[model samples]
Target: MLDWLTSAALHAFGAPTTWAELLGFASGLLCVYLVVRQHIANWPIGIANNLLLMVAFWHVGLFGDAWLQVVYVGLGAYGWWRWGTGRVEQRVRSTTRAEWWWLAIAGVLLTVALWWYLDRWTESTVPGPDALTTAVSLLATYGQTRRLVESWWLWIAVDVVYVPLYGYKDLWLTALLYLVFLALCVLGLRAWREQLRTAPQGSPAWSMD
Candidate 1:
């Protein structure tokens, strides 16, 4: 696998060899940074990261992840528009705890659907886990695009599984990226909670009835 990640194989990344990966690497970092700041700019940066990663994953033959980037592209664009057009201020809803029943139902449905589709239809060797992670990630991204604070917890859940999955696939750098994402989720959660606390009395960030 080391051979697979060597400077030679990555010559497509250009003279620095790691340029493409670094573009992906840095954009991932920036996306997390912007999200932590609660800046709407995170969406564009997130879109950039997704596009870069789509290239990276396709090269590595992680087609599932490559397809996921496509979804992120669409979601990121929507998030950018929604946030930038003052729609966020108009619709900035407070986070509520997801009900235990709904959480259970979603979990079971996602797991089963991923397992069934991947195991039965895809040529992917790791399809079951890959599909499961992708499904949860889709849900998390959907929540994040809407600025739902609970999205971080969903990310946390997926990251825990994804780190091991990437490691198993010998994607050390990608695994490292997910590790940073996990930490950022924790930071983002704390930051957003504080924002909730300090929001104006009638602001949407506040949980007014």
Candidate 2:
């Protein structure tokens, strides 16, 4: 079983693809689709995708990205809990300019720091770009838990960069998957904005809790 799993991750790294990649890919697409539909199930699906892709990235020596998937598992759980226990304060809301400024500062610091670390400590061929996306994605995941509409914008930006980054790494299917994510972000952005229109200003949008 272990050997089979190892081989799956090593298979082409998306030259054509493998069951591991396909599993991750499909779950990723479902997660995005659920996000569009405002379904809380996205988080669990995202966790599965993260685990599957972790192996896939590890086989290709994208250590930073590989470890990133592990981090995402934690983030996914937090997201699931937050959404499941939907509170009034967690409803779709606009971020203040002050919040945006702080987020920008932090995100930049994380990206630069991770870029330097990956460049020095890892054998990754594209550490700079990888770090950029990973940092942005972390913040984006946080934003989702906060129910911030701007998270979709961050995801849009990440997908744009990730497509070429994964493609250059020879993960062709993942690159294409990123394109799908890009489009889904567009859909999610619109859907969430519409939800914000109906969301009670100071009340939980749904009583999922």
Which number leads on TM-score?
2
**In each prediction, how many residue pairs overlap at the backbone (N, C-alpha, C within less than 3 A)?**
0, 0
- Write model 1 residue lDDT over 58-85, tens digit each, in one string: 6655667778899999988987777667
lDDT per residue, candidate 2, 95-136, as tens digits? 889989988998999989988988999898888888988888
CA shift of 39, model 1, Å: 1.3
Residue 156, candidate 1: C-alpha displacement in angstroms: 1.3
**In model 2, what lDDT does residue 65 have?**
83
C-alpha-based local distance difference test score of model 2: 0.82
Clashing pairs in 1: none
Number of backbone clashes in candidate 1: 0
Candidate 1 C-alpha RMSD relative to the actual structure: 5.7
TM-scores, all candidates, are 0.79, 0.90
Quote the positional error of residue 197 for candidate 2 in Å. Answer: 2.3
